[model samples]
Target: MSEAVRPGAPRAVPYLRQPAFWIVIVLLVVGAVRIAQIAALFFGSFPLATLTAIVMFGLFAVPFWLLLAELDFLEREPAGLRVLAFAWGGLVATSVSIPGSTALDNLIAKLGSPDLAAEWGAALAGPTVEEIAKTLGVVAIVLIARTQVNSVLDGIVYGALVGLGFQIVENVVFAIGAVQQAGLGDRVQPVITTFLVRGFLAGIWSHTLFGALAGAGIGYLVVRRERSRRRRVAVAGLALFGAWASHSLWNSPILRDSFGDSVPAVLAILLLKGLPPLLLVLYLVRRAHDREAAYYVGILATVRDPGLITESELRALGSGSRRGAARRHAAASAGREAKLAVRRLQRAQAGLAVELSRGSDGAGACADRVRRHRATLAALGYPEAVEGARSWRHTASTVGTAALALAVLWVALSALGTA
Candidate 1:
């Protein structure tokens, strides 16, 4: 007997037609249900606990959402993946770490004494569990979508986002617990104060910073696999240890006696603890930007295409304000569509350059990337102007240099204020 074909099956099914899509759909449905439950818990009751929970949620959720929305760099990211990352951070990570920490705390209390437990609470509970929980979300992302994390900066960004999500949910619970312990009227001031102090000031240092530190390690491991496996593991361990140390220091009561309710003192703590990580992030980003630029220039240089984009144009694209000016110039000279096309071309070129530098079929890949970018520009009605043009010389250099100068000045002023 001849083998029978599967009934109603396509002879050629695309890989996209696999079970993974349905699994994603089911996960999305479940996530929606969980989010609804959280919303109900946060807002349904008329009790002070619910109100306090809402406040805490606002403190975290607002900033987190705003930051994500405002970040134009992540525009190419898939929405589902982003949501999944946040869910992983907020739900799975939080669930595991909270109960585990509580159990360990209870064990310690029972074994030693309540006083010993209290002593260990901030030292152990806040830093170790919370950092691990939040960072695990980033780890999940790295494991599942390893290719998406191109650089160390990407890891820091993703990890920080996950941490922010966890912090929001955790804060809500903390606020509600505070309200439950204290009466409604008495709870209001503390809740508000805590929201400001924790959500605004300490929030940057808490989960996001810790996650970024850990993520740097994860990113290093993924990017630099050419190195020894043992070395990679050591680097990742060091990153985690650093994150835990930073978290512990931030939660320590060492400053409570010395600083005691002064706004500057609080700001000082934030600067001292938070600024270093942020500066590190900035430095990484700058290096990434420079490397990307150099990679692109090298690729284009092979074809003797110096006019397409110059070093200055690359520098300008690295700056926020200079990029804006480039867009405005494009709009005025060509149109809105052309302006968008130019931006898309820049991004595609940068991405392709990075791929080429990674030794991934350099010539063919670069050609394909250039073709795609050219097609986009043509569709946007800038086919002629975008091709082999020397537009960067006059506009990009001046804008980039000015922006860099302004950034330096701003940093200096900020330092003076603190001093």
Candidate 2:
């Protein structure tokens, strides 16, 4: 017998329609307030404030944009959880760590040795406290939403966002303090230098790298169910230790001295010091990409039987350059809508690939992904466009590879300059 539906029971509403939801409203408010504050603080008084804000905003926003573009790699529930986790890290984690670490440092200083404080400041205080505080956000996120962090890359993205948030606030403080310390006459140069060095180079490794490293540990624990809990704890410990070590090296007095006395030498040391971890991150991301590609192969097989797409088309869609060509071809024949369809398909293919690689391969899961992909394609008004109509392209891989290579080269060159 069919049960009668209750007349007053609330139906679930789409996330966008739910404007009253606290999370959405809160995020919106925070974004507005932050942007307004940035304008008010930076735009008035200092001539360089506008430029500084632009550079800082670009650095902070780019990562978030990239992550959003690849959001299909994450399942919805997990993705939402991740966003919340990062927000928690940025808000609660930062709040706790700042005061906690400051109090601890003060206590250590009061224990009766100023020289000890200096030594500890470089070796321990900066790295140990900073990394832990930055990464505590990732840890909290992982603890609350363990299923969301599927790969080291996921950890890196989330951790980086958390770190980026911390860095933005920290940078503001440093810049304001610099203005106070040196006054207007000397402020601009130091601020510019700090922005160049810290905002770009150290900023990458600063909170973001530390949080990512710690997040890798959390992700490792979350992904592997066969390992003993103790082993998982060890993995998290090691990752955090690596984070601390990297942070310590960056903050070390040795590097600090090199910075002003010999700028080139300092750059060289930073590049050399930072390369291994960067390489490791690249390797992990590449593997994930490959795994995602393979996942699409499986899905393409199923969807093929339904006549929704062909195997040849699937193969062409696998590569980014090919997809771009397909879009161009469609644009020429079917107009802008066709081109839009191709773009949507491209994203869907990438997302599916990532999801498949991450073991989200049940029929329901696959169907949902395919449905979303189809909806996107339909929205572009080219729902019936053939996948293989255009040749494959390698543009995506080339661009990604080139960018990574450039980053590595920049680090290497910087390191050489230091030497």
**How does each model score on lDDT?**
0.60, 0.57
Which 10-residue span in candidate 1 carries the lowest summed lDDT?
1-10
Can you write out model 2's per-residue Cα lDDT over 1-419, one digit (the tens) per residue? 00110011011324454433454346435644654565566656554755564466456656754653353232222445455545544554555555666766666688947776766665566666767766766665555444455554556667666666666656655665565566654246556545656675565556666666776676666655567899988987898898788776766665555556354565567676776666665565555434434445555556554334556557656544455567777787668777876666555554554444444444445456566666666666656445434333445667889789567647645653453
Clashing pairs in 1: none
Q: Write the per-residue lDDT of candidate 1 for residues 301-337, one digit (tens) a residue.
A: 4544533444555555544455656666667667888
TM-scores, in order shown? 0.68, 0.66
Q: Which candidate number maximizes TM-score?
A: 1
Q: State the TM-score for model 2.
A: 0.66
Q: What is the lDDT of candidate 2?
A: 0.57
